[model samples]
Target: MTTSKTEGKQCNLVNHDEIWKVHINMELESAKSWPQKWGFLTESYNQAMQESSKVTDRILKLELPEHLRTRPPTPPEEYLETTQAFIGWRSAVPGLQLERYGRVQCGKKSFLKELGWALDGCS
Candidate 1:
């Protein structure tokens, strides 16, 4: 009887795993559909991929000419103290306006669209 109960629990676990796998597959399908729905043409996608490859190749081939890559003369302790002071000043500033400005500039349209959808659902 105990063996039967254990077997039943194992079967339930397998079913749960299968359900989770199906959900992940659906999400992947939705992601693939999004770019197409956004009117991304095939040639555009290919061109973008080619540009990305070129950037990647350039990064991989980069060799800084001898003068630029040389080690800095500053002692490590001085560098560490300067970095810490900069970080402390940044932290001490309350309500960093630059961060808020960036969010407002980047997210204003999307945020309002989402907020409208959410408010509509509430009503």
Candidate 2:
């Protein structure tokens, strides 16, 4: 009985050691394959970077002729104030659609009347 117990313990130890060796081998294989995986990831990242650079270049080239790109000098404070007031008044009027009517018969007469009164304090 004692000899058999000793043999059983040795068998268990050998099985455990085999399991540990297999795990270590798998880990080493994964480590060895890392460079290929890293290369694939790096290639994908470089392609994305190139595409983003192309999009940025296209946007900059297309937007170069707009008024925003010219950086004109600032308008006077009085002009800015007047423009803001006109914009505010136009925005306050509800559902003011001007595209549906002729210029002579449209809401422009009413709008101009109110705007003139607001500007010159005369109705």
lDDT of each: 0.68, 0.66
Give the alpha carbon lDDT tens digit for every residue of 1-123 in model 1.
224657644356677789999999999999888777865587789999999999999998999864335345667766655667656655555553336554444444555475667645543
TM-score of 2: 0.30
**Candidate number achieving the greatest TM-score relative to the actual structure:** 2
Q: Residue-wise lDDT of candidate 2 within 1-123, one digit each (tens)?
A: 224657544356677789999999999999899987776888889999999999998887774533224335457773555667655655454444343353455444566565565645645
Q: How many backbone clashes does candidate 1 have?
A: 0
Q: Estimate each model's TM-score.
A: 0.24, 0.30
lDDT of 1 at 107: 44
* Candidate 1 residue spans exceeding 4 A from truth: 1-38, 72-123
